[model samples]
Target chain A: MSYSPPRDRLWFLRRRAYLVFVLRELTSLFVAWSAVYLILLLDAFADGALPAFWDWAGTPWVLALNVVALAAVTFHAVTFLNLAPKATVIRLDGWRVPDFMIVGGNFSAWLAVSALILWVLW
Target chain B: MSPLRRRAEPYLWLLFGGGGVVSALTLPALVLILGVLVPAGVLSRPDLTALLSNAVVRLALVGLVMLALFHAAHRIRFTAEELLGVARWDRFIALTCYGLALTGTVVTASILF
Candidate 1:
């Protein structure tokens, strides 16, 4: 027999950072939801039921679901980008990039791409 | 236990990290076009059907979905154990999460290709 410590299931709530971590984990569901939505888009495209795609996506509930999923995915992306430098080490010419530089560059690139997409669509 | 189980963890983790990178790089832009701009009628929907009709785009979409799905599955599997304290059910958790991801990947590929 070995000793096992009893722990609260709500341990995540006891600390703010842990809560953020848990929320980040929960974002996985929405990430999967986005993938599912993308699958539907591809399926509709493959079958040439193109109008069906627009028609279904236009539904209020679908819009709402997409809105929620979008929010979650956005949070996931932001958190991951902010956390990335901690998990990564980039060196150029035998010099490591500073953490702020890495995070700032990641954010700058994200903004540039987002602007590009919006620009093209507009 | 499968002989590959222990060895597969690191690779799966790599996939998760790669997927996170991919999601960060692509999904926000997608969400902006899809979630906010289009729905708000600020940006008109382009020839998305024509755009995605390209084989390369379809393949890329499949890759994105596949990796994202696996990343979700791995993260959720651990989250389930942590939140629910279901460590004793690790095998069940892994099977369910990974199985769903596999199904999603197959369906994504079949539909895309």
Candidate 2:
């Protein structure tokens, strides 16, 4: 006889952490959305339709959806950075780097990169 | 695992992980700028175009789009399999997801070039 764990499609809903995990997984869609939206913007820009693109993007509903996407991507970034230490173990002079250091370093780098982009674009 | 998947798994995971890191670092600022600032009329056309016209910027855009799309495709494929109970169609799902990503990559590269 073989034993197997029961499969529950809605198992993620059973726990807060599981729900968060699922939501985190779901953020990939928003990440892809951002990519596709960027591609469209580039296409419009190349085609000399900047004004039209702006008009379409500036509509209330599009702006609202982008705001939600901003939130989702931000959540994804935070979670990804927090989990960075696990994937990126470091050692300095034979001493193991602590997880807090790794997480903090990642967050600091993220802030610096964001600030640099803002400075350049602004 | 199938032989093809076995050979491609590492590369897929690499793209997924790289995309996660790259998008995590860049997407928020991008969304804030183009999605929010530009839409709000805060940025002028010249400012945006000047940035886009840079060769380095165009290259980076291509890289970002390619990696991000692959990342999304890989995650969505697995999520659909587990969450939607479509594991039996794993090969087909993987193909569709990656095919779309590849198409997006080509489109982005062509637009930039």
Candidate 3:
């Protein structure tokens, strides 16, 4: 019979990477929450959906929830950006591109898109 | 990888990957706008209806929702099973998670169109 190693419930907690992985995984929930907030913002933008809608959204609880979600989103973004190189590959004429360029390109795209959003909104 | 495992995981991973890019870029910006700027009364809500009602914006918004939802589903599904030591109910959990994501996507689409 083959030998089988016993594992505990906290086996994953033994490693630093595992902890980060779990936190990153949990970030997905907040990512979805952020999407939900976006949907609400979109739906609330009716013909007269201005002061009243904005006013309705200015509650303390909503603010707190959003703050928490924002933190989660920020954390998730940082982790995801760092991990992007691992998941993707870039090649030019049968040559593998440098890692920093690939990562920097992602950051540049992120900044450009975010800047566009800011310009559009403001 | 086993064929059965590969079939489900690759597609899920693709969604997860694409979703990761979109979510990483947009979600942070959104949190900044909605959570801090608007809430702090720094940036007021502009003509959001006009902006969102546009065909391109609506399409993009819908796509973002779908991607983000699937990302959450895949992550949450795996995390739950692993953390909870759930082995036998893997398929059921997956279906539930993906099903929820699909339903959310449908609802968002209907509302948009």
Candidate 4:
């Protein structure tokens, strides 16, 4: 006979951290959503339908969806960046770099890139 | 693992990690700018079109879309398996997830290029 461990479908609800972890995983949906949205934007531009696209995007429901996606994607960004230190370890002169430096660097790069994009649009 | 599966695993993971990094660094600002600001009339359409017309900007947008989709696919595949108690069907789940990502990539390329 084969034996398998039992699984808890409600495990995520059992702990706050677990819930956060699940939420972080769920952010992938919004990441995909953002990608699709961008493609739609590009399609609209290509079709010379920018005005229609803006109007559709500005609709209450669309705006609401995007607002929620913004929150979810932002959460994804923060959580992923915070966890970067664990995945990427750097050393100089055989001295391991501290976690804060890695985290700070990730955040700094994030801000710099975002600012550059915004500046270009501005 | 089969030889093909083993070889593809690292590359898939690399795409997942690379996508996470790219999406983390860019998605929020892109969402804020394109979704809210521009649609709400805070940012003008002409400005956006001008920016998008740049070859470098279009290329970056395509790259962002491709990577972000792959990242989402990788996470969603594992998450669905664990959350839904369907790890036994991982191969199917992975195929579906990655297939969607590939479709998105193709659609994005067609639209942009």
Candidate 5:
């Protein structure tokens, strides 16, 4: 098929959608890093070097970065969860899972796991 | 299938597998490890850096980042095309993602080195 002209395709791509898409993508970057950063911290803690860990974690800049990373992580999780059903295929008993169910499941799972971690840590 | 649909199929697969499966399985652990446990002192911190420096840890980090980056890129591109009315800018977004991935790889290599 021949390519449609931009004018003809304008209905498909609105300015607001473009902005949200860009924001979502940008947030995903932070989400990726946040995961890595967390892993690194966990590994550090597991290695049993408290002084060094505190030194790194206690830094003001690092704290700020962590806050930003938290925001990014949340954005990534929320947006990705919202898009999960559209992006994935989940078959249970020969039936496709509803999109709302998938998203709700993900959110519930995330909350449960996060709560578990907090409970254990506390 | 139309050429555009054909081209988009592989990306959809990657998004489903990498962003969906891989992300779901690994991300929660990452959050628990860093967000709650570390902050609460249940897990030691120095060990995390030391672990990161290990070859296995580094490889996993790099792999996850690369996959997630591509997934995000593909999703963003499609969103721009479908919602932003910017189908013409697909190439631009792709190029930017490629650049970001390359830069990320190089930075990761430097950190490892």
Candidate 6:
């Protein structure tokens, strides 16, 4: 029997698949960073510095940037949550948690955390 | 190594590293919920800086940051190598990521210490 590197044997197929995966995941970096930037704004507001924060956040370009960031964050969260099951290992009493359950659990946790944050600020 | 083991090495590293990040982030949150929030009768009264600056907390934070950054960097490098026709430069990319991760860890330690 003979052996060959998988990349050499399935060059184009592997490349296409990996490219798609990478692009999808790379967008997540933008999303995650945007959330961090948003937290900075929130921190400023919490410190009673809303005037400065709003001045920066209210600029037309800044507003547009926030919108894009929010969209990216949402997209990244959705895709990342959806793929969490495959990327993570979860076992309960020798039984594996279903993929749908993992996704649902992540979304539920996110909602709960978001609600808590909103309640705190409100 | 067996063929299957060799094939699985990269993915196993990613999963282990990624899982470490997730756990490091989540454990403190869980502790805050059970140890502080419920005990203090407050929903979100935990002090972020104090908790994050604690020795154990800082260790976990640094671990999560370094591992996640390296994991992301490696994954990105591989993707760039394949998609951007830079396959020959994968080693360079990997070395760059390693350097970044090492620098990050050192800076974080200095700040925390």
Which clashing pairs does model 4 show?
none
**Where in model 6 is the C-alpha error above 4 Å?**
A1-22, A28-70, A87-97, A112-122, B1-12, B15-53
Candidate 1 Cα deviation (angstroms), residue A47: 2.3
Compose the digit string of candidate 2's lDDT tens values, residues A42-87: 9998998988998999999888878988998999999999998998
Q: Give the distance in Å from residue A19's predicted Cα in candidate 5 to where it truly belongs.
A: 7.5
User: Looking at model 2 chain A, which ten-residue stretch has the lowest summed lDDT?
Assistant: A113-122
Rank the models by TM-score, top first: 4, 2, 3, 1, 5, 6
Which residue pairs show backbone clashes in model 1? Answer: none
Docking class of 1: medium
Among residues 3 or more apart in sequence or in different chains, the pairs in candidate 2 whose N, CA or C atoms overlap within 3 Å are none
Task: Please give, for residues A1-42, the per-residue lDDT of candidate 6 as tens digits.
Answer: 997754453354567875556655565344333323434433
For residue A31, model 6's alpha carbon misses the true position, in angstroms, by 6.8
C-alpha local distance difference test of each model: 0.82, 0.91, 0.83, 0.90, 0.61, 0.53
Task: Give candidate 1's total backbone clashes.
Answer: 0
Candidate 1, residue A22: Cα displacement in angstroms equals: 0.7
User: Model 1, range B1-113, lDDT digits (tens) per residue?
Assistant: 56788888888899899888777777767865765556556666567766666888678878999889988998999999999999899988998988998898899888766
Best by DockQ: 4
The two-chain DockQ for each candidate, comma-separated, is: 0.62, 0.74, 0.67, 0.80, 0.17, 0.09
Give the fraction of reference interface contacts each candidate recovers. Answer: 0.63, 0.75, 0.64, 0.80, 0.10, 0.02
Local error of candidate 5 at residue B12 (angstroms): 7.3
**A-chain TM-score per prediction?**
0.84, 0.92, 0.84, 0.93, 0.70, 0.67
Looking at model 1 chain B, which ten-residue stretch has the lowest summed lDDT? Answer: B32-41
Per-prediction TM-score, please? 0.88, 0.94, 0.90, 0.94, 0.55, 0.53
User: How well is each residue in A38-122 modelled by candidate 4, as lDDT tens digits?
Assistant: 8998898899888899899999888888999999999999999999899888999999999999999999999999998788767
